[model samples]
Target: MRAIKKVKKFIERSPNSTEGITFAKLILALESENEFPVIELYQLNSDEFDLAIELLKDWRIDCFYVGKAKAFDSATRAKNLS
Candidate 1:
């Protein structure tokens, strides 16, 4: 959950940033049966970009299931709503 918390904090610190929005969407994709474009990450600064890659790596290796499960549940709910 640390990585997810860090990413949430990063988004909170710069809610209006393109990187924030992009990361938010990327997280959503990670949580669901969806895919995000790798090219979009090129828009981020090094730190943000690294975090995005870290998220992917963590998710790929199934390192954070509980948090990802919660995120996926939330995404499923929102998708069902709209």
Candidate 2:
């Protein structure tokens, strides 16, 4: 709980830290409990956020609303993966 709070504070102080911290914390959490936690860490753009979300979706981690539509749509269309 303390670590999670620290991560949240770090994110608030440095919004750009999402991807790295998120991935690292997620791996740690999964390793510890064999299951992901349910929480939304905002600030990642949709495409970048989606990559992480998809990786953990089956584990029940939920990463909600993170990017502008234009950017997300463009990325989705360009990659043809959405």
Candidate 3:
């Protein structure tokens, strides 16, 4: 996955960005261009990816799926439980 490789390269180059803006920009750019390849690339490393997870917690953008999936799945399961 070249996209994943690119993101990894970016992270490697900028490993100390606590602001997460850079990761957000990468995500947004991929999404804006409908680049699923890039998007999935990011997802693969989302767990220990960056500070972007915190930044994207409340963001309305569709690019943040790291924490989003667990939250969404939990909600759906809870509804089913109820």
User: Number of the top candidate by TM-score?
Assistant: 1
Which candidate achieves the best lDDT against the true structure?
1
Model 1 off-target regions past 4 Å? 63-82
lDDT of each: 0.83, 0.56, 0.53
On residues 3-74, what C-alpha lDDT tens digit does candidate 2 reach at each position? 445445545676556566676666577557555544544555666466555555644432233336667888
Cα-based lDDT at residue 13, candidate 1: 93
TM for every model, in the order presented, reads 0.66, 0.37, 0.28
lDDT winner between 2 and 3, please give it: 2
In terms of TM-score, how similar is model 3 to the real structure?
A: 0.28
What shift in Å separates residue 74 of candidate 3 from its native position after superposition?
0.4
Q: Flag clash pairs in model 1.
A: none
